[model samples]
Target: MSPAATRTDRLPYSHSSRETKDADDHAACLSNWQQRYDQLSAGSFSGVFEEFCFGNVQLFREGLNQSVHQSGIAWPGSRTFAVPVAIEGTGWFGGEVYDAHSMLTLGGSDELDFRTPRRLEILACTADARALCDYAQQVDHRNIEAELAARSIAPASPEQVTALGKLLATMMASLRATPALLHHAQMRKAMEQALFATLLDTLASATTASASPASCRTRQLVVAQARAYMEAHIDEPITVADLCIELGVSRRTLQYSFQDVLNLNPVKFLRAIRLNAVRRALKSADANGRETVADIAARWGFWHLSHFAAEYKAMFDELPSETLKRRI
Candidate 1:
């Protein structure tokens, strides 16, 4: 059989399930996730709901609530990887806590055994190994599979970890807000390349000691503290001075720390985080147009409607109203 010619005009397949309320609902939501594997199961019962699949990868932002779960993923000898962008609550994966820094293997025969009493929010990126290698070859003629296989859960640099999280969040938001992008072949392929490149770069540089371990750990702690503060007070107004006081660091120290980790100052990072939060609130709001964009922005600390709209568009490639209206 010959390969079919690529169809530029074909619509990209998009699937999203409503919120799951029971075991049957959860199974329906996770049907696609299990289809890629040969065997899968869950220990305890809870809810699972999500929108999955984009381009050559499956992008999942899952809302999970359960006591324990286990699955055997067999991708039929294909090389593939899964990145857990952000993990909330606590669980165990391979005898270690499955936190924000962990990556899951989706191909081959791998097992996922985890237990947690609380709910979890997880974003995962799963892609084909061959496609990733082809993308890596364009950048550097190295053995991409060798680099990927070097570590099941590659320890990424702090900045790389943060970047990957942002990439997943951005992709999820974009797919939901602008589903038309899925139909754009060139755009989807470009995004797939972008994802693979980030994975390759992060995985390949796992062992390079460009920075001292102590310094790296310290910087990660600082960034984590700052993020925690921002997330805790997301609805309250925050300033650089406020962060400095709350984090027990000077203004210059805080500025330099954020620059090193996020490549953006503290203020910009807060804005970006708030932008994402606002976008989420808009998407999850009532579809009957009962909620206003201004209300959502204000909830996320954006009081200036005009300024918020511009920054929202710049960050998400769409107006705030557009995101809300799309839900309807």
Candidate 2:
């Protein structure tokens, strides 16, 4: 029984016997780790893959004070997966501390660093994944989902843990909720199956009508690429036609993907992005009063002052001038 981790091509169905032994230094902290993992160890299943929607949950490792992410993707289609899974046991890193609410996203092939001096538990995700992929062609959700998955290694969210704790408490209180229990492998089976079924359905139906997920109208991989391009060239003028050429798809195809995946046409997407940049600038601009709404708006590509103001107000519920006016 050691704190050491065993790697595998897939989850080992019999890992419960792997026993977690601790160094004398970490042994005192075992109860903390045990308590945290036990709180969220739903169930396990036999499979090469398993998934779960984190209702609300969180965890803090044996002996850490703050969670610090190691290295991970924060954007969608960045190869960071958006699958949901369980949180269990002590992690491989020293004192795997985590927050009960850091908006975590989980995927394979990534490592996370967490630090919380006390025990922690967390879960985020809801029962309503809501028709997984029914709107995959919509670019917005896919983008956000991709980004969420990439950022999953960051931390758990309080909202998430609350949901998870409530779910488990209601349905699993009698089964086991102790850090000292030998193992709840049998109990974990149902949870694991649910996760597997969810993953299979979601990943399979990720795109509205792509022959497969990889080829969806707005393949998450491709939209992620487009977002990156837009971010890099925020100051430059980008057109839908340009994006179509860059993505190697026709204009209609691009529009269709964005429409389905994000519920937005390209122009709207670009405007929203530009407005965001303007808001950022306006927030930091001094009313020592050097910046003007028109100045910032035009710079961010919003040339028509009246039009930009209307759009900005609609999106952010505030006017650019209002933000600047507050400074006065």
On lDDT, the leading prediction is 1
lDDT of 1 by residue, 34-72 (tens): 321111234454555565455556666666555435444
Give per-residue CA lDDT, model 2, range 100-205, as digits (tens).
Answer: 3333444323343333222223322222222222222232224334533444343334454444445433322222222211122322332332332333333333
Once fitted onto the true fold, the runs of candidate 2 whose alpha carbons sit more than 4 angstroms away are 1-219, 233-242
Q: For residue 317, give model 2's deviation from the true position in Å.
A: 1.4
| lDDT (C-alpha) at residue 77 in model 2 | 15
Overall lDDT per candidate, in order of appearance: 0.59, 0.40
Candidate 2: what lDDT? 0.40
Write down the worst ten-residue block by lDDT for model 1.
1-10
TM values, all candidates: 0.53, 0.32
Candidate 1 pairs with clashing backbones: none
- The regions of model 1 sitting more than 4 angstroms off are 1-10, 31-48, 77-89, 114-117, 206-328
